[model samples]
Target: MSRDVVPTYVGTSFHVCSDRAADISRSGSRTSSLISSPSSVRTVTRRQSTSANTLLTLDPRRSRSPSRTESGDLIVRQPAKRVPLVRRTQHEAGPATPQSSAMSDAAKIQLVCTLGPASLDPDVIRKLDARGVDLFRLNLSHTGLEELAATVEFFRRHSEAPLSLDTEGAQVRCGSVVPDLVLAQGAEVELTADEVQGSADRLSLRPRSTFQALRPRSRVGIDFHGVLLRVIETGPASARAVVDRGGRIGSNKAVTIDPSPILPALTDKDVAAIAIGRRMGIDHYALSFATSGRAVRRIRELIPPGAHLISKIESRAGVQNMDGIIEASDAVLLDRGDLSREVPLEEVPYYQKAIARRANRLRKPLYVATNLLESMVLNSRPTVAEVNDVANTLLDGAHGLVLAAETAIGVDPVGAVDMVKRAIEAFERIPVGLDFTAPGAETDGALLTLR
Candidate 1:
């Protein structure tokens, strides 16, 4: 039997009764044994090794040398690998037939929709909620407290989905630039210290005081499509600079009048909006231009404890301090509109990926925003690029995607939200770098895209 290892084809495996032990059987040239307990398992194999002689004595070879030359002793005891217990989420604990945990995490990616003129209807709100829209963003930049409170009331009465109020942080904007002050090749645009007279329909110029903080000739940028700015010009009432390139500037739209936004977290407008948000039971507040943890802390000091804060990563400062700012807030929103203004346009995608990865790691839900379907505002559809952008970010693990002009003032608000939901679902199905089985992973993170 030990001349050489031969192919042993098993015919019938006989199982022992009441023993729960599976072992080799050899009534012929094979082997058989009964497995009992740890108490008996070592005994069975130990017992079998030496006991082989007793059985072999019965063999016709009657005392021939042991048949199993190098064959190791049988020990049918699998260290009883304690099957690890799985931790289930709340939804799993419910009656949903225990869907794949992968799908479950996908469902957890908080879907936030911005509400405005286009999406104000009760039915539309109900539809959005049904489709998994987890939160509604009220743009405090445009909607005053009264309007916001009313919107909040409508949302509460219509659905229990959460609320995120976005407060425009202190940002510089172009003062009145003669509504259509078109600059010819040689024309000069001036920001005067004096206000446009009453006939000019403008308020008097006031010093922001922080502007004094600027050193002479530092760059003061007023950015829009692409940033066209000027170096500081020293003056008595106001400063003068040329719009190296020109575009239409409206009254109070926003002027970097200076280098950085020189104000604190809670502007007078923010304070008022926060007071109203508290009264209205808003769940979260979005702080634009969130520069440091201190900015969120300042706003936190003002809002009621029930309400949380989300930092809007919109500027160079915001991106540079993303980790600290994200640490300070309950959530984060990547506002690419202002963000593009702050970073090189080519770099926004990279920023989006980095920010999403950081937020996902911290277990904080993140929102990607700005022109995500901007084209859909007028057209009923999105280009292939816009579609892929949403999917890529979803693959990147973004918790939500925000639509500003697409939803706020878009011609078809409900349609825009529907489009986003579809894009998300489509992306979720596409194969990506995600191993959904891994912990803390969902379809929204770098889905194995070709870099």
Candidate 2:
């Protein structure tokens, strides 16, 4: 016999047993019913106020009671109480100074931190939330749906902070390296499309297209800018190169080939992540390696309504297509780490200002991510330079700051968040006159003119 499937709100279907029906009897003008199913047997009390269409299910065995009605039917009743949804607010500590008081009511900067082993503890997450982390980012690049679901559920149970599902969009990286090979300067190496044991001489480059698109004289960066390889020859399935710079390269580290438009904007893993995000009720999604307005629209189709889409600008193509991407996306993220590989190191600041300017002009939220506090990954405090970078990013009209490794694997996740909050507090101390001509000014000049 075919089983009747019952759809649930939790994105899963369960079979319902319909073979047995409830037997109703009247005892002293009171109606009692014995509801029997394959799962459990329960007694339901009939009330004049109870709707006829109401469906009843037996409570779990642990919660079941031996109470019965006059007709000897087990007594069951619908729950009379429910847990109310209460919104939790973060409390800022310390004595409120003139600067802190002025900035307290001012527009607050949103802080987004990536989740990992370092910040997985519920108590740690609670501390981070209380310290003012507005959202938690789940990087899908490192974990799959099963693991992601559990993590999301845990956060939902423990805190009120929303989740941002970050997709590993079309970003290519080295798959595996054997023995953690180290390359010396002027040494020849091969980047092959096939999965093989990587040595100092050859490494595995997945997606295959990255290898096929290579040309002689092209540069390849390995291990997050650790080493550089200059392509000397290209073939159908591999490219031969010489180590321009030497360093220790490990397995699963990111690899960057210069001029990265050859990579796709969306990958199969990204598609699966979107479906899971929708079911999990993710508040926002950060699309990595975004390059064009068309790519943003395609991802929008997959995402459900009410969820914000953030386009990560991390490549030369993404920078060139900034206007279109900003227009299409709810927000734009400046991924400085990967973007530095596409453009000159010195030009990253210029690109950041340019992108921030355009995004602000369009009234779109701009997020500055990556290396905001590199020192804090190991240190308990941020260096002056790192703090200055965060302050300058805020001055550039960024609406948010994204902490990746600093909070994901850092030694002090709470300290990193506290530092970011202090940086924003410090930036707001500079009092400036409002300009109405500013496209995305927080307030109109007329409002301040009366003062």
Candidate maximizing lDDT: 2
Please report, as a residue range, the 10-residue window in candidate 2 with the lowest summed lDDT.
17-26
- Every model's TM-score: 0.65, 0.69
- The lDDT for every candidate, in the order shown, is 0.56, 0.67
- Residues 166-203 of candidate 1 have per-residue lDDT tens digits of 87775654444454544432233445546463112222
Model 2 — TM-score against the truth?
0.69
Q: What lDDT tens digits, residue by residue, belong to model 2 across residues 1-451? A: 0011110111111121111111001111112222222333343433221321122232344322223444454432221111111121322211112343333213467788999879988988999878868778888776666687788888777787767788877677776777758899999998888878889878888677787778898888887646999999998888899999999888766778775537677777778878877787765788888878998888888888646778999876787677788888877889998887766565566567657756655656678999999999999988899987886676555778999999889999888898888888765543222223334333432111111
Give me the candidate number with maximum TM-score: 2
| Model 1 quality (TM-score) | 0.65
Q: What C-alpha lDDT, on a 0 to 100 scale, does residue 419 get in candidate 1?
A: 88
